[model samples]
Target chain A: MQDYSAHIQCSACPIRHRAVCARCDTDELSQLEQIKYYRSFQAGQTVIWAADRMEFVGSVVTGIASLTQTMEDGRRQMVGLLLPSDFVGRPGRAVAAFDVTATTDLVMCCFRKKPFEDMMLHTPHIAQRLLEMTLDELDAAREWMLLLGRKTAREKIASLLAIIARREAALQLKKAKGMLTVNLPLTREEMADYLGLTLETVSRQISALRKDGVIALEGNRHVNIPDIDRLLEEAGDDSDGGMLV
Target chain B: MQDYSAHIQCSACPIRHRAVCARCDTDELSQLEQIKYYRSFQAGQTVIWAADRMEFVGSVVTGIASLTQTMEDGRRQMVGLLLPSDFVGRPGRAVAAFDVTATTDLVMCCFRKKPFEDMMLHTPHIAQRLLEMTLDELDAAREWMLLLGRKTAREKIASLLAIIARREAALQLKKAKGMLTVNLPLTREEMADYLGLTLETVSRQISALRKDGVIALEGNRHVNIPDIDRLLEEAGDDSDGGMLV
Candidate 1:
């Protein structure tokens, strides 16, 4: 059973406060409804082709999507990960610049391009909020550039684990003593793509980390951090702990 | 004698339009004058410290600069190359996140931060223009992210050359058959920092490109491209050539 509610309410919703859509009012949501539609994609499906015509802009209501770029030789790079409540698509552009693929079952709350741009023009706050988010994304991208260009292979692997662990910790979960656990949302191959390394390298690095007692692995995708400080040291970051702050 | 008069104009001005200060109106310029100052740095001078207090926001009125991040062990990544017209600071940020350094004899047009933000509230147009330029910078950052996260070493070098050559071509200078050249602008060490390679790797890759006849080197700091298409192919990029188009 699927839930497809048209109204955009901020309170009591699972994604309330965190999602950018939370900023909109009932009136703005109503205006959005006049020009909006709903769409869903199955896991492993591509929602849009690279450089193909894009007639809509939208946000994710549920599930995860990834924005990826592919080379002619079949090499792929995952440039962005779109989680639930993440925004997708672009306004003022007629073509999608990258491929939007569903990494899991996904639902999108979409708006037709023309009317959405009109709404952006009429609603100054919307554009302002978008600007702020875009700036934040830019900062994140630059930070990633540093990681990709300068970090060692071990450092890269550690950084990736730290990022996942921090993100998972922020999901309003309770912390337990002597046990820190995080689920690996991505496969080794996907992690390799994101880290600019090969799958074999990713596998080897994970094993190395485990052998060095920096981490404990349970199953293929579950990570247990015995000591967060040890994990941070393995990451080669400042002793500021694994949190981004 | 300095030609300050020749450089003074608004963003709408036809001849002197490269500096970010060009976005100011006459009144805004006067306001800027009250809080502004000029400083010059010799080539290789560090202008700002990463993670330190940033007292001002400014632009390069002449010459070139770079924004770079360094690892704790001294590995470096050039996050941005600041050409004329490039804004040098973030508005809401109180401390520098990366180090800024001059790559040539640099003259800057700067404004004190408190006064600038105060003015931004009153002059929506300036804020709007700033927003547009910021958005453009963000796009450039995203493009760089793809370069760092995905490109091979050879592709990275070729892409950097192509970017420099394309921007140089846009100045509409007279073309010389043997002079489709770009001044290296960066030293071998700086190139290493920017490309995430060692100095030896940078030299080796440049030699390989020359040996392959993809590009011609004139001394160590100048490059000549026989054909843009050849360069693009070596970059592993499609010859959409939309940049020049």
Candidate 2:
């Protein structure tokens, strides 16, 4: 058996506290380390395509990946956006259901499918952790559904920005208050795809938000939110601040 | 203590084969039955509101319930449509996350929260089955995201009809291949909230589909499809047909 433990240390990984292995104890971690390997993908690379046979199930270790679906006419909608620590692939199903692509340079900690399923039977921690993660993803997906189905183009832009900023703030705790800067992983066209708007609408809405003093753009990819609460308001979120995140 | 087992037999339950209790054996089912009781809600009744304390987690036993979120200004989006056998309530959370409303008269099999959580800790089958159900719901939610974010109003209508038809077919089993009729649980206004269209737009699209011979309407509720395959095409689904289900 290959000693896969040398790939990465779970102790020092950035996403250690949040990933599927979050609830793992030392022995369970060692078991996972033995079966795990790391895979990397460049920006704009396909991680896995829908209906393809997947040999492994994994978690996003670094950067961003997107779960997207394309219609027969070539129209695409991004269903889920994966930041570090978000899971990928489903257990029990050999074929992937949606196209997963690396929207940013990506790295994944993977375990071969069969053994992982077997281990899950014996390891309740992993299965429980996966359930929690899946539940959270389901909630996020529902929130995104609300954004897609009802929010206006301008609200969509603000909501996306606020979501990205809030996620960033989650990682760098000190930068959450007052003014904050966030780098958007998607381009304008991609944002349009995610929000169900045309590229022109996305661009126009971003400009409109900037002009309205709800946000500021530092560079092409960097957005400056002088007040996070103000941005949330523009997103049509409630004063409770629980709407988008 | 209250002789709850006398309330219902797991074997006779309609959703037994599909719900969170699906994998439970006779012994496990006995434990569930001890803690289970039935709750009924009338059409248009609010089952639970967002953030309200929920005493139990349960499964929809009959009719339809909708998971919806509303903004301060009164914009509402229906995030999930629950059918019989669909699970309800998050396991770890004490409060509900969305307003669950019975779109039709509904019945649910409920287990009080504390005992249910304790039961899950000991019963791998229940937890495993719940995990599987959650994962399936997540997949459905993502598919819904795609519909909300990308599909046109006409395509959206077709997709909703196709989804309801396919789900109904899953229960009936014999009607999968060809022509079929489906009972739409949501009214035009409810459907509008669901599909992100105004009521007028929904009525117009339904009229357009009927005029084009894509679907036939009987009164206000039942929809007749002469060709399910043709309807799927109008929904922009691929030939292999895994898009909406």
Candidate 3:
């Protein structure tokens, strides 16, 4: 764990426009500056365990994290992937409902739960912005459900690739069209957990996609899309309508 | 379709305390009343097709409705089930993302899109309440994702039964404990669509549960859980933890 508690001015933040505090005015940002702190975790660190008490709610400042659930018999499923600017922790809940683990060395901007909840009551911008983000997340989760329940193994791989490619493009401030590349942030086992497939199946599907020319692999972790539309077609998504999200 | 334009007083509404207007004051309610109207749909009627222009947003006043997505080949998946007081339509979005159909004859309290959006902008209470509800819905959706992605067929059936039982209990203001009876709002085929199971598999699992004394069936649409804990155990959930939702 990296404990760098130095205060960073809100205006200097990289995620200023995309984070939960995106809509906050100067006074609100100053208020958040008073309540916010930074925390960093090494890759594979468990940030919060399921059912544990969570004292803070925050957003990812850098790197990746995942929310996962495990059965009594040890079957685990990754329910959410949190990337840069993604919000974490429920506003009104004291206890965390899922285990949140950092998939890469990560930094988060956090606010003490009580103050944050109080701030939410006073700031309509925060509440409304959070609502919009949550709704978007809900839409994304439903799309994931469709992939998990109905899509075949190959389609699942294609869909995951497309999702990552889009996210990567967005992060780079580039259009998600024509030639695109994405570095796989997760391992094959993690991809399997996220996609409801086994490691062997995930590996097989990646190889299949590579062979089919829907995507090219420069290495195990890097993927190149020759044509975004063809990749979307393989993912069984609407290639023209941009409806997959 | 039934069109009922008669205005119902907000004070006399059954869901006054639980709907999106739950946090609204008398003045706000009067504003809502001015803009609200009633629309009813027969069972099996399509309320909104996917990608169609959504002219209004509303809450279910009576009976069950579902949001479903259909693939090009006609495979369908139910993304959401809307019961009484459950919200319909998304604010800030012009097009409906899913095909909403009434599973039972339904009545809704609706507000025109432009007015509702404008009202949400002016009313912090409505926006906050909607944020809370959307968060709850997101939590429920993630739980559903776990079931869809990882649970076994038997566990899936048990989980669905438990979900319905809990919802039914909540609607009736009864405790979801001890011996409980539930009337299945969804047909076997509909349940299959929601659970990602074939109708045959659903039937087989129901029969298996009945034979094993985990549940008792009075008819196709009526189910009795002899012991709620036992059912939860069969569902592979923590009976004491209340994590199934």
Candidate 4:
């Protein structure tokens, strides 16, 4: 990890409009600026190990990170796929509850926990925003539960792609419709971990979907959806929308 | 549903101390009382359906409710298992997002959504408490994701029982240790749905646990854990503590 605190300004931060500080007014932004720092991590770096006493609460300003848990014997489950603007850590919690790792080169805008918690008590905007984000996270977690518990392997694969593509579109203020493209944010093994499937199964399912013309591939990591609606149908979702969290 | 507003007061409510309004002072309590009402549902009744226009936000006062999502092809997944003091509806969301069914006879204390949203804005204590609760719920949901995605059938069943027993003990300010007892809140089929297993799988696992003397059972619902530590071990959890959400 490296401190890039001096390299960025909150005003120039790419995720400023979408992060935990999104609701902050000018004065509030300055207040946040007082406590905020930036931490950068390389791909595959462990950001926080479970049970570590984290000194900060933060949000991803760039790239992706994963929140995962492992069993006693070593089985792993990916519980959260964090994207740009997604808040990380719990305000009142000092100990990290899950292993957080950067899935790609990442940057986070962080605030010291003590000051952040104190500020939350005094700032309605910050607290309200955090609450809203937490609720959204809960909803996402529940939806992920549904996918893990009920969806078939192929459906799970399709759902993961659909979720990524839709979110990608959302970031651009558009709908994932007739034709679109998306990058597979997770690798095959990571996808397997996230979906609770064997890596072979994930590869086979992706191949099956490709052979069925539901999607086009530009390699293992880039996906082209020839028809997004058909992809949703394959994902066992409604055309209007599916997989909100 | 029947109105039971006259039968209860917040001061006498069983879940008051643990509920959404847990931090409310006298003035806040009175304001809440003015907007609150109680609705009761019989066992096996539908409390709310997906896409239905819900009129209020609420919390369960008694009994259990299951939040479920169904695919167009009729497959279902139990996404949330609501217990007493568990919140019922999203405060700002007027459309119910999942099918909420009473797994047992249930009573909910509800507040109209508009006022509840207004009150949340004005009451820092309420918002702060809600944020805390929401964060806790998010943690629980993530742990559920781990269970659904990683645990074996036997481990899943053990985890569910262990979770219930722990929560039951928590209510009494006791730790679930030697010879603890708990009731199966969901039927075999519901457990099957919740655990991503076939009904036979759930039953088989339960029997296997009994045969191993990891648990003892009387009738279909009551369970006796002769060794809670052993039970937690079987649940793929740490003996010191595990499964907080």
Question: Pick by DockQ: which candidate is best?
Answer: 2
lDDT of 2 by residue, A1-245 (tens): 11113223444443345555666788877877778888999999999999899999887777889888998778899888886667788788888889999999998888899988888887766777788778878887888888999999999998989888877775665557788999888999889888888999999989998899988998879998899888888889764345323
Global fold similarity of model 4 (TM-score): 0.92
Question: TM-score, chain A, per candidate?
Answer: 0.86, 0.91, 0.90, 0.90
The residue pairs found clashing in candidate 3 are none
- DockQ of candidate 1 compared with the true complex: 0.48
Q: Which CAPRI quality tier does the interface of model 3 achieve?
A: medium
Q: What's the TM-score of each model vs. the native? A: 0.85, 0.93, 0.92, 0.92
lDDT of 4 by residue, A136-244 (tens): 7887787788789988999999999988887767664455666788888789999999999989999999999999999999988899998887887888864344455
Which model, 1 or 3, shows the larger lDDT?
3
Flag the better candidate by TM-score, 1 or 2. 2
lDDT of 2 at A118: 88
Clashes of 3: 0
- Tens digit per residue, CA lDDT, model 3, B68-161: 8777876777888887767888898898878899999999888898998898887887778888778878877888888888899999999999
* Each prediction's whole-model lDDT (CA): 0.71, 0.80, 0.81, 0.81
| TM-score (C-alpha, index-matched) for candidate 2 | 0.93
Q: Supply candidate 4's per-residue lDDT for A223.
A: 94
Kindly report which residue stretches of model 3 are placed more than 4 angstroms away from their true locations once superposed. A1-11, A14-16, A176-178, A239-245, B1-11, B14-16, B173-178, B239-245
Reference-based TM-score, model 3: 0.92
DockQ of each two-chain model: 0.48, 0.75, 0.68, 0.72
